[model samples]
Target: MEEIFDECWNSKGIQVFVKRDDLIHPIISGNKWRKLKNYIQTFSLNEHSGILSFGGAYSNHLFALAFVGHSLRIPTVGIVRGEELIITSNPYLNQMNDWGMRLHFVARSLYRDKEIPSEYENYLCIPEGGYGSQAIDGMDNLVHELPSCDAIYCAIGTGATAIGIARATSVLVTGILTLNNRAEIEDHLKDFPAANLKLDDKYIFGKYAKSNADLETFCRDFYEKHQIAIEPIYTGRMFYALVDHIKNGHIAPDSKLVAIHTGGIK
Candidate 1:
């Protein structure tokens, strides 16, 4: 896996590094691999009929799981959180379909009640963004494999990896929230035992998967300058917030900040 340190080096004064978890496992790179590691290991491919998970149309978790299941010769199902619609030959969805993942659509209203759904009986109910206890269990290995650093930063969607990372290390964990659903995220993290996890909701462009011109420009220029592809969903926001924090003197010069590159470079 190529670790593009160039993106972090542009801070002028701040010394930043990115833990390229996105490159750890090819198709299953980043947090999705961490979140699904245990789940994948526990069952034999022949034991279960298929693996089922939830996601939005463009979800990296869904894409990763589809690839993993297909490679392992396991049937997969995706409960997409939207109204049923025809899927075109877009790169991401096309790849998932090529991998033979059965895509199912649910009403956005029904998706909000995911936890108590009666449809989850036979399927392994992996939540959206791969949150919950299983994901935290898998993410426990993320920071432990890295060198000691002053702070570890990542973008927060479901808040599972942040909680797990903070719990697994003494380093300060700062999460940039991509969702306006901070209070809801906080409520979800109540059971997790992470000591130094902090959430910043200000960097969220508007809502999940949404971005503004500043972010778009930053992503384009950052990729052009460093040749590292970053999608707006997670890594882009983390990169933006990290640079802004350094520029604003929020990060100390002596601090060794490591950002988790949970990659989905679309």
Candidate 2:
């Protein structure tokens, strides 16, 4: 937990701190570790053949999973979305393949339905982007890792991290939506009726994984100022929204905000 001094928030009399989950590790850092912690803990080789998960060609989740599988000496399978993508499509995919994760490319049509191949029925299949009850349960400890603050900020991917933090704390949890998944996120929040979570999609900047010049500029400027790395996809939109809110007087004065740097900087 590090307190960040920025003129936008400072001028408004709001204290801003960033929970640097990105520094948790070089590979399995940030919410990747948080979301997968329980899945790894509950897995037993005797009970299950291996772990299977879904992702795209450059999925950070799959990359981290592959590393975890290699480190734990557990068999792992990754059902890649694009059938055209292969093990050598990109360096990230190549690294995941090198880590010994069986890369099974599936048709985009079938991947949409999240159909698990019949041969891996025995494997424990984590949902795409690690968004499931287990992943949400895995993030239960996020609140304990924070300093006292009035609000918590985090980028919503599977909605697990923000919801997990909201469930664990009474403070306001503001999730900046990086994509157009408000309904999906709301569905995930149904199980947690008392969660103090708010979803903001204003800063999506068109769609997920899409970056424009302004976003790139903010991310670059943010790094120059704070010396903390944040990519435009996840953490960038989050901090951008946080700064915008403070600058527009949306955040109350004297409010202490903690932003979770959920680590997408590969």
Candidate 3:
């Protein structure tokens, strides 16, 4: 974890630190590495034909999995969400291709099923956003590296990271939802203990993968001031919510708060 020194945090009377899990690797950085670690380690190439996962056009999970497949020399297949992406050439998809991940695009309707299609059923299916039990187990181990604090905060995409951290730590875990799917996220976390878990959806900006001028300005100014790259998709929103919470007296004064930089900045 890296300590963030800024006037905003200081003025709020809160000590804030960010877990630099993003620094773990250049390609498979942050919680991506942590979440995929156990799955990759235990995966047997001989036992299964290949690994199949799901994601969107710019999914960090897909990017990281492509790298993992390249490094491990395993055949990886990505079931893309949007069929339109199949005819389009983009950096993310291009990189996945270069990494030897076979791309299969499906309609948004079928993608909502959240299951690997029957034809690819032979391959080991990893869930979208890497939110399976293995990922939770991996992230639970990540919590061991964190220092004790009054509160822990992270951006919630699939809620796997937040749920994993919440289950492993005694401190209150505040998950800032980047998407406007509070009910779905709540259902996902139903099985987990809620003793000190909180979900905040006030700073989604518009919706998942959508941003506005205010968010862009904040991200630009924040990067200039702190030299920490934060994308509006995840980290930026979490930080914005943190600042807002602190300013509004939601977060207690002088509390040591740890904000997890879950990466995917690029």
Candidate 4:
């Protein structure tokens, strides 16, 4: 946890600190590792052949999986979404291929169903973005590591990280939605206490991974002033929402907040 003293928030009498989960690893950083850790640990007990997962061409999940598979000598397979894409489609795709993950691209329609090939059925297949109960344990682990604060904020992608934190802790968890999946997130988190988690979609700007000039500028100024690395896709939107809330007086004065930095591997 790193406390950042910004004059804007400081002047407003709000305190901000960053939980650098990105420092967990270079590739399998932040929630990536947290969400996948359980699956990897129990792989040996299962009768599956290897670890297989689904993702896009530039998926950080597949990228991290490939590296983990390489380092641990565990066989891995990636089901890419776009049929037109291949190992050479992007540098990250190329790297995943080079790390020994067998890549198979399929039609987007079929990818939406997340179906594994009959041949790979024996492989332990994880859902897209690691959206399952497996991630809850990992997020619980993260909750144990966090400091006490009035509220905690994190970016919402698959909703696993935020939901897990919300379920495990009484601290207010605000998940800034990066994608238009509020309904899905609400559905998944319906069983948890509603007050523990709050979903905010105002910072999405347009949609997942979409960014404008203002967001880019904020990221640049953030790095310049705070010396913390953030991208517009995930952590940037989350932190931006935090500051915006502070400035907008959404938070009470003298309140301290924790913003999770959910790393970038793409």
Candidate 5:
């Protein structure tokens, strides 16, 4: 888990150091690996029984959980948000199904609270993005990877990673919100003891995982310029925002910024 801090001297004279968390692990890496580590350690997982929970479709957590649970010989279940959709062309859902995760799709509204039926109460339910106390414990340990940094920047999804990092580290954190639900994020972060948490509302391209031509171009140019691959869902937007913030002189030149690259480049 060595953090890469190499400076890329590009042709355009733009210098950037890439922390390649994408190379963390083949099946489980980045934030997902760190978040799941404690859960696997603390819980006594049997040969064919464990509960993993997440959204209906396009959930990175569900995908990662299915992969890890299967590898560890634990039978997993994904408590998805929203009613079941028609069985058609859905790559994400189909992939999870192939991975042997029991997909349970409930009403979108109820999925938020995750009040499961009485019959299934015994299962070890892992919340979306593995939030709650367990996730905080795992993320708090992530500081061991980077003991010293002036600031940390990570993409904001459910705010789990941000909250965990903010809770774990004393360094200033810049969480780039990637969705329109700012109020929800603020509400979530309120639970943490905030000493260095700084939420920025500028990077969310008006929607979650939605990108305009400029963003797309930035993604393309970023790869072409630095050979660092970033997904549009999380890391791409955060990296772009970081570059923008630097260009705007928001971060001092002397201050070292460590961008947490949670691998989602699928």
Candidate 6:
């Protein structure tokens, strides 16, 4: 955890700190590492033929998993969400391929089934965004590393990270939703106490992977001011929401808040 003393926070009479989970690793950083920890530990490389997971074209989950598979010498398959990515080559997909993760593009419809095709049934199947019972255990580990605060904030994709943190700690967990609806997140976190969790969808900036000029400008200015780079998909939206909450008096005066930098800048 790193304390960032900015005049913006001082003006609001709030103390702000960022948990630098992004610096945990170069590739498998932030919540990605936390979410994948138990799964990787439980499954032995020799026991399984390969590992299979689901994600979109620009998914940080796929990107991190590719590097993980390469480092562990495990054969990996990424069930890509869009079939168009097969013909269109981009840096993210190219890097996943280079890292030895076999790309299997599927139509968006079939991807929703969340099951490995019969041919790859033998491989270990990991859910989209790494949400599972094991993921909660893995993410619960993050609570131990965090400092006591009035509230904790993080970007919510699958809600696994926020739910895990909420379950493990008494601090109010504010999850800035990167998606359009909170229904999916609410469903995933149904087992947890609702009073401990707060979900906000106001900072999505249109939709996942979509950004506008204001968001871009804010990220640029934030980097110049704090020297911490945040991408639009996760961290940028999270910080944007945090600042907005503080400025609008949503966060109580003099309250300490810790924002989890969930990485995936690339």
**Which sequence of candidate numbers ranks them by lDDT, best first?**
4, 2, 6, 3, 1, 5
lDDT of each: 0.79, 0.88, 0.85, 0.89, 0.73, 0.86
Stretches of candidate 6 off by over 4 Å are none
In model 5, where do residues sit more than 4 Å from their true spots?
1-16, 45-49, 84-88
Score every model by TM-score.
0.89, 0.97, 0.95, 0.96, 0.87, 0.96
Per-residue error for 63 in candidate 6, Å, reads 1.1
lDDT of 6: 0.86
Which lDDT tens digits does candidate 3 get at residues 81-112? 98877624688898899999999889999899
lDDT tens readout by residue for model 5, 1-266: 33333243222233344456677786576777777777777767543247767765677778788888778777788877768653243777777777787787788888878776665566687878877767766776666676466788888887888888888878898889888877987787677666677888788888887757888888788788667777777888898888887667677655666788888625
**How many clashes in each candidate?**
0, 0, 1, 0, 0, 0
- For candidate 2, what is the TM-score? 0.97
TM-score preference between candidates 4 and 5, better one: 4
Worst lDDT run of 10 residues, candidate 4, spans 186-195
True-structure RMSD, every candidate: 2.7, 1.1, 1.4, 1.3, 3.3, 1.4
RMSD value for candidate 6? 1.4
lDDT for each residue of candidate 1 in 1-266, tens digit (9 for 90 to 100): 23344434444444567787878777778887898888888866456567888888788899999998888887888877777644563577777888998877788998877643355466666778788788888877777677777888898988888888888887899999988888877887778867699888878888777758888899898889767778777889988998888778788766777889887735
Runs off by more than 4 Å, candidate 3: none
How many clashing residue pairs, candidate 2? 0
- After superposition, which runs of candidate 4 have C-alpha atoms over 4 Å from their true positions? 191-194
Model 1: lDDT of residue 60? 86
Cα distance off (Å), candidate 3, residue 75: 0.5
Candidate 2 collision pairs: none
